[model samples]
Target: MLLAILLPFLSFMIRGKIITGIICLILQFTLIGWLPAAIWAALSLQNARAEKRNEKLIRAIKENSK
Candidate 1:
C-alpha cells in the first residue's frame, strides 16, 4: 500500500514533473484516507489567501510609489 502510493511520487521525483507529482500525491492521499487531503487542502487555501494579501500589499506599495 505504501509502495503503491510512493510509486508515482518517486517517478515524479525522478522525472521532475511537478503537475503529475501533485496529481499523484492527491490521489494517494485520497486513496489512503481523507485527513491528509483535508489538511493539505486547508494549507493550500491558506497559502492562496496569503498570496492574495501579498499581491494587494504590493499593489498598494506601487500605487503609493506612483
Candidate 2:
C-alpha cells in the first residue's frame, strides 16, 4: 500500500479497475485532490482485504461443518 500512498491512481490499475484508475489520474492532476486520492486508495485496499478475510472465514466454517 506504500505505492498506493505515493501514486493513488496506480492502486486501481493494479486491481484491474481501469475506469476508476483513469478517474483517479484526472483527480491526481488537480494538486488539491492528492489527499483525497490517497484516502480513497487506502480505503479501497482495506475493503479488499476485509472481503478476502470474509471469504476465507466462510470457507473455513463450511469445511468445519462438513
Candidate 3:
C-alpha cells in the first residue's frame, strides 16, 4: 500500500503489469496525474490481495469437501 502511494509505477511493475506500469510512469511524470495514479495503484494492490484471499478460501473449501 505504501509502495503504491510512494512509487505507483514500480508497484504495478512489481505486480507484473508492465504495460500499466509504463502508463503509470507517464502519469507520474505530470504533477496533476500523480494523485490519481497513486489511487489507482493502491486500489489495484487491494484488488490483488482480495483475489489471493478468495483463491485461498476456494482451495480450503475444495479440500474440506474431499
Candidate 4:
C-alpha cells in the first residue's frame, strides 16, 4: 500500500513534469501495472483538451470584436 502511494510521489520528487505527476497519481488509483503509460495518456488528453478550449475562447473573442 505504501509503495503504491510512494511510486507517484517518487516521480514528483524526481522533479518530473506537473501533468506527468498528475497522471502517475491517477494510475496509482486506477491501474497499478501501467502507471507510466497512464502518465502519457493523461498528459496528452489534458493538453489536447486545454488546447481546444483555448482555441474556442480565442475564436469567441475574435467574433465578439467584430
**Candidate with the greatest lDDT versus the true structure:** 3
Q: Model 4, 28-64: lDDT tens per residue? A: 6756446654455445556766999999999999999
Residue pairs that clash (backbone atoms under 3 angstroms), model 3: none
Better of 2 and 4 by TM-score: 2
| Order by lDDT, highest first | 3, 2, 4, 1
Q: How accurate is candidate 2 locally (lDDT)?
A: 0.93
* Candidate 3 lDDT score at position 38: 99
Clashing pairs counted in every model: 0, 0, 0, 0
Deviation of model 1 at 44, angstroms: 0.4
Q: Candidate 1 has which clashing residue pairs, if any? A: none
- Score candidate 1 by TM-score against the native: 0.53
Model 1 local distance difference test score: 0.57
lDDT of each: 0.57, 0.93, 0.98, 0.59
Q: Which parts of model 3 are misplaced by more than 4 Å?
A: none
Against the true structure, what is each candidate's TM-score?
0.53, 0.95, 0.96, 0.48
Q: In candidate 2, what are the lDDT values of residues 1-66, reduced to their tens digit?
A: 997889999999999999999999899999899999999998999999999999999999999999
Q: For model 4, what is the error of residue 16's alpha carbon versus the real structure, in angstroms, after optimal superposition?
A: 26
Candidate 2 C-alpha error for residue 50, in Å: 0.9
